[model samples]
Target: MVNTPRLPLLFLDIDGPLIPFGATPQQLPHGYPAYRSRHARPAAEANPLVTRINPAHGPRLMALPCELVWATTWMSDANECVSPWLGLPELPVVDWPETSESSDEDDRSGLHWKTRGLVDRAAGRPFAWVDDEITEADRRWVAAHHSGPALLHRVDARLGLTDGDFDVLGEWLRQRLEAPSSKGVSPASP
Candidate 1:
């Protein structure tokens, strides 16, 4: 039997990275832009904010050389409401642990609540996390904790994902894909 190694994981956040918010009046001039997708359900079925997600992100994200996982509080709702808008298929969702006093301590320290779980999910595999909430604390923690190569690409909440964000992600993920992996993963896997 041929063993197929899984591709590197890309942990995605829906709120800020996919659905931008908090744009200043000068930044938006008009209200948030609406993106149309033939695959999406009727507008009446969706919350108005979900419409801000750019459908073009679907193809662009699909083009990236990694596996996508939803790492957002929106949970399965992201699959139900936002996926169609992006024309993206249902992706695995990260089930966040119940927040505890320790989590509060981390929050006070500027550590994002999602950081540890994301690292645990990676499980020594190469991974990238795209979120507007990512901070240097998160990056430092990931660098010290995750065994494999990782990229914590922070998208601006006001802009969501941009060409610059895509460029950075593509470069980092492509490099990880081309190089021989420490996990004995072959770069040539399809």
Candidate 2:
């Protein structure tokens, strides 16, 4: 098998992968419910499945090797909602193509619109997309369209970035980084 290089970009989706959907009520150490209905995905929201990553899980995600980018359908709304929740000074802003009038709720194309932003932002560097909606078609599209070391990792909505997930990502990163570079594509220095 031809070994690929490490991914430099980590695309993080806010909703299902990062936050649990329709979370049940449970009390926290602070006595307030850590995640009550507050964490549930609203059916009518533009990106219903999108929500903030839990405060407790934020640091572990930040410790990963790649550059984490917010890749959600919420667009700038993700920036507004997640920044304060994660205690980040500011969220990285992403650009998208101009929307057409035909774009509607049924249209899944917008997710790809966000993905395109990710592709451009990476500037030919390798990337790993972590999101809830990625499918076989999306994976094929990413492989065909993106250049170098592309990976698509799906996350369980309830667990977010679990220890298992981190271990898997870490192992993948380590393996790729260990591979000898070919085709002049350098492995990620991260």
Candidate 3:
């Protein structure tokens, strides 16, 4: 059997994960409210995808546990919509492998594809994913749901990640960084 390597990755989502729901002083992305208005009614709770994101918390992402990369429906559009709002450089695109199929259809189920890319880029390593719409299905499907060397942090969209979240993430990365292969257990999610 061939040995598969695993790399640590940090996948950052723009709308719900990084940004909170109903956050004010919000920078409305181009064609945002209009685009969202077409979907659900105002104040609809089920539309998790249409929530707001907090720009203030953007800086904190720089200090996450692993290599930070944008993971959102925006895809490369984070360059314009999110980068300027955060006062940071545009996030690098996580591209699909060359062999993947392509069509004009706007099917944006690219999280798994991007996750696969990050794993291969890091050489079969582990990673942490931050997203708003990460259903229970996503958590169960990734790496058999053991919270192994890889991590998947599904943050709350309303409050955004807090200092406590950082502490947890930091501790996990610190342990792995300190010990290359130590099976240190991470604290369970709050």
Candidate 4:
């Protein structure tokens, strides 16, 4: 029997990646289209913004060769509100560290608050992170700290997840999964 490798983890953020905001009138001339899900509950009815979530994303996300994990501030609420809206099953959520005070140094360093936690969660497994807030600093940090192949794809907040974004993510993950794992080899010596 052939043993199958574990799928890479896909760290998904809500606000920017799923629930897009900050789009100007010029950017979205027709405004963001609202979508209604048949699986939506009465509680979701109260929140009109939930309609902004596209149900089509459910199938698109599921098609990716990775496990989807919620990495949003919405916490468990994402399972309640978003999952149903997207027709996605409840996935694992990242429990963030409770740091009451924001350190100016951390901000100035350009590292996102979620960067370290996501890397730790991957635990040497290949992973892809989707967020509008990803910066070059986060990419550098992940490349330096993570032993496995990682892709930190950034989405435009105004545009949300576009076809181009999905194409890039899918292609990267496909390539990563197809490539042989380089566990102990040093890139410098190769």
TM-score of 1: 0.83
**How accurate locally, in lDDT, is each candidate?**
0.78, 0.57, 0.54, 0.78
Clashes of each: 0, 2, 9, 0
Off by over 4 Å in 2: 1-7, 24-52, 99-113, 180-190
Candidate 4: residue pairs that collide: none
Residues 1-190, model 3: lDDT tens digits: 9973333566677766665675443444445456445643432453344335334455666655456777666777676656655555766756656545522121353344444454454443455666555544344445443334555566666656656667666766656666546432233354
Relative to the unseen true structure, what is the C-alpha lDDT of residue 121 in candidate 4, on a scale of 0 to 100? 96
lDDT of 4 by residue, 7-77 (tens): 98899998877777975444542433422444445636756666656567888999999999999998998
Which parts of model 3 have CA positions greater than 4 angstroms off?
1-7, 23-52, 96-122, 145-148, 182-190
Q: Over 4 Å off in model 4, which ranges?
A: 22-46, 100-104, 180-190
Worst 10 residues of 2 by lDDT: 181-190
Per-model TM-score versus the true fold: 0.83, 0.64, 0.59, 0.83
Q: List the pairs of residues colliding in candidate 2.
A: 15-50, 15-51
